[model samples]
Target: MQSIERPIIALDFPDASTTRHFLAKFGPDAHLFVKIGMELFYNAGPDIVREVRAAGHDVFLDLKLHDIPHTVEMGMRSIARLGVAMTTTHISGGSEMLQAARAGLDAGNNTRPLLLGITQLTSTSEAQMHSEQHIAGSLAADVVHRAQLAAAAGCDGVVCSALEATDILTATDKEFLRITPGIRPANAATGDQVRVVTPAQARKLHSSGIVVGRPITQSSNPVAAYTAIKQAWNLKG
Candidate 1:
């Protein structure tokens, strides 16, 4: 069995107050790996990241930046100063942009965060990709191709679904990080996600890490919900 890392809880709350209230549920001793997405970051700004990190939790700043090489390089340089545990860029940005993003991280921080490249969003279906993006071939193949690009560009990993994690890992390297989102626990609602899997399913699929949202965040008891999902993710085969 592949060693599953700690589950990253998505802090999908609207503002800093709500985010603080939610994180407080885990108590003072709790140390979590939390995701700060675009919505929250746009509302709360980088101070939210600082606040979360000050509380001893690790942050995955999910900006999903996609831009020209120079622009992305500058963006990553600024983000690196936040001292996040991980951050993301779009693999579609191509190798030059990916490499530029890496150079930015190297220039900015002494201890650089793990840079992950986004392959295909979990919300996007194969049909959607075919009709809208006009990308040929299977979505899995595209994801693997992007993962290869990410690896070659010096990225630490790629953000892919559990459905394609093993294939991407096989195509790239076994040690390549496959941080999967769209993780729904057993019997949980799938929400807007199209390529979804349960926590246990993600583990079985050899996902290196998972990003869980609503199930844990919207639950009546957030800490208990988080614990349950983490347990499910860590369950041995």
Candidate 2:
């Protein structure tokens, strides 16, 4: 997996104007990798992606689509036209749905966006997985299984917690992307995430990329927070 020098900032804002304002905090020379999750995407629509790209940043469209294979395929076709660098779907949707989604991306553009399967959400605790989801295995096992399923279905990578990346990466090839969320710096709040890791921990685990939100986006000095996280992530032995 290619190393992501800069952390992917989550633009978990309410509207387009706020999102734009947040990105502007990094200034014109910063070439950022930003995530437009459900809140922002649903509110701002697809045009916000174009606007961000036009500002010289890469977009990770995090709608996390999960549905019947045909529905996901059609939705992905529409998503492909937006020209994002990455997008996600639920791996629990199974191999057929993953394959269908890939087919749709291939149909839409010669260079499809990176199709990342979400193995397990960071908010889901192991106890919750067993009680609520009624899964029979460890959360790590479940995450690895879903990642393998995604790999077999031709997905480029998976959106997993850094806590599970090592196991998932061991099951898949080196080139397979492991883009982890639930990342907080050592000094940051954990928020609602249950499997949070610091930037240094994620980098040590060899994660392909790390997605961070509040530590940067909600900080009084968003740019400084981002720079601190970036420095931590790139710190050498």
Model 2 TM-score, all chains together: 0.98
Q: What lDDT does the true structure give each of the candidates?
A: 0.92, 0.92
Candidate 2, 167-202: lDDT as tens digits: 988999888999999999886789899999999999
Across 1-237, the per-residue lDDT of candidate 1 in tens digits comes to 234467999999899999999999999879899999999999999999999999999999999999999999999999999999899999998999999999999888647988999999999999999999999999999999999999999999989999999998789777789999999988899999999999899988989999999999999998889989999999979
By summed lDDT, the worst window of 10 consecutive residues in model 2 runs over 103-112
Task: Give candidate 1's error at residue 139 in angstroms.
Answer: 0.5
Candidate 1: what lDDT? 0.92
Residue-level lDDT for 158 in candidate 2: 96
Query: How does each model score on TM-score?
Result: 0.98, 0.98
